[model samples]
Target: MTGHLHPLHEALERLDEAWGDADDAGQLSRRQLIAVTEALGLLHRRSGAMLAEVAACVAHESRTELGAASLAKEQGFRNAAQLIATTTGATAGDASRLVKVGEATAPRRNLLGEATPPKYPAAQQALAAGRLSAPAVAAIIALLDRVRLTLGATETAEAERLLVERAQGLSLDDVRRLVTRAEAWLDPDGVAPREQEQRDRTSLSIFERDGRIHLDGDFDAARGAPIVAAVNGYVSALFAAQKEQIDPEAPDAARRSVAALRAEALSVLCAHALGCEDEAPALAGASVVVRIDVSDLADGTGYATIDGSDLPISVSTARRLAAGGGVIPCVLGTDREILDYGRERRFFTRAQRLALAERDGGCAMCGLPPSMTRAHHIRWWKRDAGPTDLENGVLLCESCHHRIHDNDWEIRIEGTGRQSRVWFIPPPHVDPDRTPRLGGRARYDVVA
Candidate 1:
């Protein structure tokens, strides 16, 4: 049998021979150079087609080898079909697919089974030059799969033409370096592409907002843990002092109200200092306030005069004092008004609040900074059963607070005596079978 050459193939071979002779002689006129350059352009287009043909053949051979391996392993071998999947880092399956393609295209020998396959010269050159890494080669294989999926035979040729044209004058190492730099520049957050794929598969939408920063968008609780602890520590200290003032058998509602007031007062004081420059100076010299009031003994008006000024005390604050932390003033006369005042001490002094913040650190639930959290009442005083005791208060990030109270969730207080306990009940999705979970220390013992 005799092999025949098509007109285009003959023309390309003639041009290749001419270029080969020109290189050997090391001499060429201006006209000869122009002719050679034009021929080289035509040759590049032809080479692109050849490369694509090689790739297709490689793909076919890979499918056959995969089938053979599966059959040898006693696994089911379906019809040979080429598909790329990555396994390692981000493109493990892609490497496997490429390997299979190389195996399938190998020369077949009736006696020897299979012979050595022809090298992918361009790819090999790039790899030898360190222009391409294993990962980059795998990426190319993945890209080829995508091209196969989206392009028909004719379109696939055009796609390969485009890739080959773009890859001109570039070695594999250069391509690899370009791709690696591009990927890092595009995604600096360090989220692995495979993880990103999983996130996409799960349809989890994590995006930034323009106004009123949303906590759920950035789900990192560890970062905010310190701030939560700080707020909780401050609340605990206020409650401990309140417990000393009130009768041991006081009502829960009163105790909660007083605790809430103390906590809020501390919060307000802290906020004032942190928010205002003038107050910052005052805070440095300010002493802690620990005032206690009896809710039942006071007028039903729920108002008390502190420091000669009549202040409207909410039922929340009144209840807190009556339950605990009530400092009784020595009444001069029979009237319910005070005569001789005891030592004037702040419930949450500047030093105490700062120390509490430093100790607790941040929000216990999400770990947001203390500045980002709101001091929350575990039991709402409006319910009349709530106590403002330190045990009933917790430091929750604003988002968690809204998730708890505004979302119809409940927070419980456990433990006993001065050391109270707090637990948060997650919404149904977090844990359907499990009840609410409690966190943080039972006692308010500051480390330093």
Candidate 2:
């Protein structure tokens, strides 16, 4: 609020006075670091709104109707976005977003020069107040614009207000999820058409580049959901297996990054699809999970959600997906007894895996999701002659399992069934006293 300095400049000066120099950020206490980051983030959001307003003005001055008099033409740029991008050092996409947000949020004037509220007044207010980031504002505006024609003016305004409120203090991904759900809720009849559009756009291109096969593809939400689920599951397994290599100096030490693991997972997925199933069953643990309200399923009026996907599908599409062999149709609210086969089978059964998933809540050590974990024997099946029952079996990610086995960590169960707890005992190398670290859901405190 300083008289001479701009608001941003004033804010920056205050920030610098409070936090010292930016270079010393690393030296700050944890609380100071968090506070500074939050402050900086708010400044960023405010600055983005400022930039958007300016960009909107520039775009108006560069309108094609002006022709030779266009500001962008005079500046030797193709258009306002290009000029703004060059001036601000922003990417083309970012510059376009700025223009769109600015135009949507900026005050409008009628033919008689009467000022009116912005198209997305809620988003505009939130951005100006620094309650929403540029990306969040852009997302809300885009969704509102998309559904503007289909929805009434009152409904559109209410949706904008609700989205703006909900989007605050949320990550971009979370905002996207909110937008997706809102879109489905606003236009249930359009869900099927949108799904069809995405399906039509699905494509994959494979080419060899410098001796490596490069795969570039795009899939609709319905088609991509299963692929994503499978790849993540496999990657989790690979990462779990990688943890087994504890010795950094060893010849077999694993150091593959997530991208590399994803490539391997893709190759394995393709191989599995081709009926070259010579690998362990853990690699095929990927299953697409879909959830729909019973009423929605019966009435066919609402949307269904696929796991690992932000997009919503029509109930008809959900039914089709659920019928697939790869899709696991799990019913909730069922009271079933946990099956325990003591040494009857060499490997843990699917029923046992579900029960273990219930108890462990994913890799007991790493807290990966249930889909990414496998039920393994706490007592060695072949070596210790452990049973394949619930007591001896444990759910672990491949990484944790390897880390446990390679590092000589021991797992023990404290109780029985859902009331049970898992503990990992450290070896002499890790803990001279061989302490027991809490494992499973309790370790993550997922229950409480």
Using lDDT as the measure, which candidate wins?
2
Q: Give the candidate number with the greatest TM-score.
A: 2
Per-residue alpha-carbon lDDT of model 2 for 1-448, expressed as tens digits? 5542265675576567667655687788665675677778877888888889999999999999999999999999999989999999999898999999999999999999999998889998998888898888998889888898999899999888888877776667657757877888888889999999989999999899898888889998888977787888877655445466533443221566777777777887787768865664244366676666667777888787665465778888889888887775443322335577888799888778766765675678866766777789988988999989988988886778889999899899987766688988988866678888776655422121
For candidate 2, the 10 contiguous residues with the lowest summed lDDT are 245-254
TM-score of each: 0.24, 0.71
- Give lDDT: candidate 2, residue 78: 96
Alpha-carbon shift of residue 188 in model 2 (angstroms): 1.7
Cα lDDT tens digits, model 1, 229-319, are: 3344444434444446543553342346634644554565567657785533111122212122344235432222111111123333334
Mark the regions of model 1 whose C-alpha exceeds 4 Å error after superposition: 1-87, 90-361, 416-421, 427-430, 441-448
Candidate 1 structure, TM-score to reference: 0.24
- The C-alpha local distance difference test score for the whole of candidate 2 amounts to 0.77
Q: For each candidate, what is the lDDT?
A: 0.39, 0.77
